[model samples]
Target: MGVKAWLSKPLAAYVHKKQQHWIQHPVEAQKAIFDKIIRKAAGTKFGREHHFDKIKTHADFVKAVPVRDYEGLASYFELVQQGVKDVLWPGKPIYLAKTSGTTSGAKYIPITKDSIPNHINGAKNALLAYIHETGNAGFLDGKLIFLSGSPELEEVGGIPTGRLSGIVNHHVPGYLRTNQMPSYETNCIEDWEVKLDQIIEETIDENMTLISGIPPWVQMYFDKLIRQTGKPIKDIFPNYSLFVYGGVNFEPYRKRLRESMGRCIPSIETFPASEGFFAYQNEQQDKSLLLLLDTGIFYEFIPVDEYFNENPTRLTIGEVQIGVNYALIISSNAGLWAYSIGDTIRFTSIKPYKILVSGRIKHFISAFGEHVIGEEVEQAMDRTMAKYQSAELIEFTVAPYVSQDQGQSYHEWLVEFSRPPHDLGDFEKDLNMQMQQINTYYNDLITGNVLQNLKISVLPMGTFRSYMKSQGKLGGQNKVPRLSNDRQLADGLLAITSS
Candidate 1:
């Protein structure tokens, strides 16, 4: 074994011991974090506004601070941008993670010195957990690639600002620097397609062992590798053993990814976001993520059904139940208090606190009150495609198709297939039936005549990619919404195919 892998074994053990303490004492861990952050921020502007010092319990917290999305915190963010100190947190943030996709456009999320360790260590511990479990630190000896955004930073309020992935790139450990791939110049290329080509050239013959990225962008890399070398990814990089991914469910892309790799390999799923690093799949066998209770953040959940209500019930970690969809809220070291990050999740196990990201609060389809979520659509598609082994899926999305002249409105599926199915009608029937089986409300809508059966619209190959590129969202954490309540995305897809 190489020095790094040999050294990781002991470090992994120590990290695992720490992880076990929090897992066994989840509530206490969260309570400690809650008290620390609240006490520390009590003197800040937001702390004074919400009377954080006066609050002593979760109930008091709910009563004192209301949950808000990025837009709701705009005024405080503006003050911070104007170089105000102690407005949201104790002082100015060391950096701001700039992201897009919110209705208000770009959001500048603070990352304080106290909070930076959570983002960095969350990822570090995840890998260490793997090493501790399987004794597979051999990946440390080979090249590791992270297909990420440009690390270039611009100024926001005199603080360095960039994409979260880019910001994390700056913090890559000194030890791992030699194993990281695609030299700095290639990573900074402005266009994703151009950057991808350069990455292919740089790592095509390297001893790659680990690959990390959002699934779609990684798929693009795999595709380019196959075209360039005319070999399966496994054959191209025989040492590749670990795949780490986040931002979307992996089930829909699992089959294609496995096909590209020529075999299944161990994988890890993480629940990291610009707001906080919340969870990671700690076990090789268990797909669910263990919520990081000891991280410098406290979590709250509001039932999805009650999310839009005037006053919703907010539950602490101890109050959450398995299988119930909840809009995730967090109070983190980054100075975000009672902040709704717009994502929804469900607990799979409460014994040690495991969760699956169910969907986004704003990214659901309730156009006809059916209330379908991202998880359901992804699962339905997964099941349907599993039966059609010969066909290959590229990308897909669903939106409600409202008829203008009083005809029945229905759900429309726009899918891009790299390898078309033998029988398109049968494929559509299976997909519709799968949706009906997974979502009773969608089934009811069709059966009750409120909506017709869902229709499949086979988009030409590359249509989705073209549309995303046109919108300047072709890569780096941008994903096509799996479920949209309206027809805007659908119309955009159709326009691209037609043009």
Candidate 2:
């Protein structure tokens, strides 16, 4: 029997067992997880200050700790960087995941020993869940490649530091290492262009059955692979049946990826931030991802409209409703106490709790009362790209032009296209029309003539590439922010293109 098949029976059973248990007691499952985490970290400085020892119930926990963004929690993190123990978690963190940033600068997020399993097992269970539903375990037998950051870690205040994916790469189970592709040495190369070339050369002929990464980079790798082999991805790896992706909205990339592969593969999406692995597509046939309730993280939601208010109403898992855009707050075993991870998600299903990421909390465009959001931008891009079959949107960012210069305000889009539309003006009009369909506030402004039509600049190719390089976030889970609340990100990209 193959290694994957031999290992599947037990893993599949465990996944099914957990699924059944979670299904029967969805709310209680999270409550139990919350209690366990609170008790585990009760000895820490944050725990002591927040009275974690007394926090027996959800109401008490909420009363003890206040809602905080990254900035609010920075003080504790600063101490932890100096190798402080028992500050947030019970002891020192095993590793710190350094995240890519634009507005906030590079943020170092801790990964405690207690939280390590939550990060690793959460992904393991996701794959097990996929196998359980699809009855496909051969994926485990062949090589699985993770297109991640350089695995060479650095030290910060005596704590190991690197990208989250790179951290995970160092910890891939001993059993899976034999089936994993690309040598450890190659994975440590920092330059993406150099690393991608090596990765293509190494895996071009391997028996790779699964590939996982952020969609854009994965697409880029596949494009390069096809160019090298003179064949589509499916042709190159006939056994490739699973493609795992996340980090950015898959809607816009879905069309492009499907075209690149020349066929569809079963793919799963995940909400994996540096704070915690929050959710994954547990069901094979559904679009909504099941929240990882049993993971070592306590989940909370605040309605997006109320998120910035002085005293916004915060809702526990039991209180969240379907279809409301919510900014997610998490308290984890990793030492984050009631921390806002800056991502927004909406519940797509109430039973068993499945959600769709609406956007980043900081990534929005609301200059002229339009309240445009990430979800709208994704859907609009999807629709427009679908309309013009020949057009390909490589990457893009949008900003509001709240200008009194032309006697009107507008939203300006900077787009990088792989294949330019036959008529750029027509493409822009279609994109604007699609945007109006999804965002009523934006449409109303246009209809009232209070705002001019959306202005689009067809960026010279490599515009986003240059910007990401300049910001030192060239690849590996970094993406261009889709909607900038201000013009900083868009303006930065414009500067890159102009230079």
Best by the lDDT measure? 1
Q: TM per model?
A: 0.98, 0.96
Clashes of 2: 0
Residue 437 displacement in candidate 2 (angstroms): 2.3
CA lDDT of every candidate: 0.91, 0.86
Per-residue CA lDDT of model 1 for 383-426, tens digit only, reads 88889999999899999988863438988999998887899999
Clashing pairs in 1: none
Q: Give the Å shift of residue 110 in candidate 1.
A: 0.4
